[model samples]
Target: MPDSGEVQAVKASNPGDSQVRVYAVAPRENADPDEIVDGFLEAMTSDDPGFATARKYLTRKAVRAWKPEESISVLTNAPDRDQADRPADESKGRTYPLSGRQIATVDASHAYQPNAPGEYNQSIHVVQQPSADGKSKEWRIDSLPKGLVLGEADFLRNYRSVNKYYFASGENWVVADPVYIRQRQDPVTRMDPVAQTVKALLEGPTGWLDPAVDSRFPSGTQLAPGVTTLVTDDQSTLKVPLNAKADRVSAVACKGMAAQLLFTLGDLTSVRVEQVEIQGSKGDRLCLLGKAQARDEYAPVRNAGHSENPYFVDEHGKLMTLSVGGRQPDRPTEVPGPFGKGVVPLKAVAVDREESHAAGVVQEGRELRVGSITADEELPPAVVTSSGVRPADRLSAPSWDGRGDLWVADRNPVKPRLWMVPGGQGERIEVSTPWLRDGARVESLRVSADGVRIALLVTKDHHTTLQIGRVERTFTDDGQTVAVTDLENAAPRLSSVTSVSWAGPSRLVVVGTEAGGVQQVRYVQTDGSTSATSVLPGLNGVDAVAAPYGEQAPVVADSGNDGIVRLVPGANWQPVVKSGGSPVYPG
Candidate 1:
């Protein structure tokens, strides 16, 4: 061991130079009108606190009236700058046009929609103004669009998503209420992200998600007064202190309150809250146990189930499963059923959540049939519905809801409608889709896991689009099944959708070509408020896609050349079966 003085001398000789260098760039100080426009646009990407630096390039009047959070345009690439009109005098005001293909647009509620083609361009008007120093005239933006524009990559980098927990219809389980958050909203230092997530949870669900989900917090419940930060005790336990209002609820409701916080905080990658201790404003612990607890302690009430793996029909029209990690016995093994034997080629197929039953459309695209996967003998599939319409306007692939109901679209031009086969056994029941516009046909539809929502791919005026709506089940006075109401087009901007599937509790994975011509797999929140980054870079002829419920479950798709492609972690798309089409996961 070296002496204190020797250690100091050694430290001096071998300095630990692992210091981080933060190069702070000063805001642009140019006075040229063109330069001012450029600087203003550049500063928008900075995400500066309140956009302080970007305001420097704006006139006082314009800055006061502008609202940055009004909207955001996600462009395919950087804006193309052009001089709209040249002023005769260099010092006079002029306008510059910045145009780009917008892939998506986000509203104030953070809901993302695809912007209509040719409607995403921006026009900036810059004028001469007296500088703050009062020494010289400078060019500053006087009038501009209401929203900010950024490249897709930059937009994804600055925004993130966190799901707030809410009670489902029965309150027997909890569902996720996804909401967008700035990437930096959660602090990195002294601020606890787990605490911040809880605060967001206390705010309740967003407008769109509220009607579909419910909260368990008491009417006036809130965080403890005068406490803005979340405190954690030793052993990584989270101490959540609630107001006096929380005490008004029953013991069961209090447990639900604890569950909501635990699920929301656990979802954050930045924080690992193993145990949560719920306390009252007076520091008295609430609910049963009155001690720190783990997520497993509350798993009985969470939506902890996931969907079964995906199954697909091979090029030869044999139903098979891709052996992932030996989850399935035979690699690309033909399923044990009539459809699996290749007697009747299938166009599209869907399996029930229990994996015991399946529904499919025959190759002719006119007949929809249902069969059992657990049947040992080669039994004939029962035909549920058959359409006499043209192939292009005939029956689409089948979808299974959580209730084991089979849903399919009958796009007969003269009588376009949606039909459901109760448990794949009873007669076909025609469901009313009144919200579908005139001449718009349902190309495809998939029901969410909870069976409360449905995503429809509608084709109107030759444009294929995706929409979502509430699934209102109506019954006769005697409790007999009647008409099913579809509140369609929940995600209006997911245009030209080729295929889609529920990828999470409240999120859907959509594959489509945006207005900008970028075709890839993207995730959209069920509320239609935000569109996340593409799940996979791009695939050739992604005719169909399917995903299970969990976060890390394998996503399979039917594509050309590569046949069946599976999305593995880190890797984008890898061939699974080598040749298959129309993939479907258990609903």
Candidate 2:
């Protein structure tokens, strides 16, 4: 019997801001068919370690055949028995068919994507099985599905996406690699939240993201032998012991490893990891100097140099920053640059992180120009021009990287390529991305605040899909070069993606159609897991969307209603500006 616990969304205070839900554990019982079925379903949706209890409902043969990780179906309701079945026989096996509508499916690799909301039927064959004491026969599932299924709310309660840190390829900084995990584990369980995170970091990234990210932990590295739990000491310090393999690394490398641990552990919402103490196999603390480090040098740069207010291009093609937080210039003020002068009929725009530069596409969408946000002089020259390509095949909305470089992709099917304007000016360098294939043309691109990733909305065969790729960079004596590689589908299940904005370091707000074929605004993790949070409410006719940083207010261009709408999480979308399209935030 499962505890009578109701599922509810608990807002996360971490940077990811994705909702975390709590699930109650089900008590063990294996008597009748209904009890066995109820307990099995409840256990499948729990974060129980080893799933030892769930196996109790199954016969020895069925337990061995079931592979819960093979797939997970998200449903809107609990699976109910097929009413058409005949009465159960006490001496012979009986099949209990269950059915529900699947909202999504999590594949073996744990990629959560939308699924067509239609009937999904499964079954379990049950019969009397000898008890552990051989004293009595109990109803046990003789056959079961290979994977698991749970209502949408239960899925949210048991699973969450967490970012484990890895050193960038250059080892100059750390990068977040998001992965799904249990939000809360049983206290008496072997998989401690902190320990599980450390183990995952050591295990490294998935096959698809391995090329784009690197780990400081050495190859074949493992946590110290017999290490199954991690708890802070009386002084509130987390002590993590690693195998002897890490002892040979230099102090700098040790520090980098510690930094990765610090950031990754800090992202755990329920844990308060004030400091991380890394230990060697011999039980001595390594990296003493780095152990008490308070600041995270690898965290994404936020508001430091970014505009405190949001901005949009008005109907007249002028750039204007909205007055937020009761700041000066009460009314919407035009930016102090060529965009403010309205000389170019701009169709789309983006500003650099420092709010010092701007990039936009001309009304014809055939040219991409960059200019100083505060410059009173003429607009910067067009850095990219498509002379023969159709206007619609010209360029996408520009995105500014943390390095102050501008990125845009030409939609020309004949020669489509992403271009990087280093420092937002000068030479137009073609960024080769072999994964942007199948005749897909870039529709929009937004760089993450960390600058190592880009979210892309691409159209192919008349359908649009959202994808994420790594921006690999190399610096030389002459300058820097960048390329977007390892492009992974972020919303492969989405049929149409109109807009995508970075809501947090490892999270994106995606507007698209679900596999069920309904359009809505929802949160998506970089690793392709859909957020359990409900879709943004009342978002209609959103042509574009812009977000400043981590879970901050996001504004949308409601082209259908001729107004700009602002999204307040858990609330309705409020109309902000009366007219605008292609709204954008400072890079």
| Alpha carbon lDDT of each predicted model | 0.69, 0.73
Measured by lDDT, the strongest candidate is 2
Tens-digit lDDT track of model 1 for 1-587:
65566323331221112131212233355556777887788777664656777888888999898888777887766577897687798666899988977767677655555544444567888888877798887788889988778766566666666778776655355667666555553221222445556766887876555665678787767778755467556666677888887766777777778777777776677666666667887888776332234233443212334434578887777677655533432377777878788778888888887788778788578878777777755545555555656777788888887666788888888878888777777776777677555898888889876666678888889888777766655556744343435443444554578988988667788888756576777776775544343446678778888877776567888777777778865666777777678888777
Every model's Cα RMSD, please?
9.6, 6.1
Give per-model TM-scores: 0.75, 0.82
Q: How does candidate 2 score on lDDT?
A: 0.73
Q: What lDDT score goes with residue 573 in model 1?
A: 76
**Candidate 1 lDDT score relative to the true structure:** 0.69
Residue-wise lDDT of candidate 2 within 123-235, one digit each (tens)? 87778877778887788887887787877666666667678877667645566787656566632236776777788788887665677678877887789987877887776
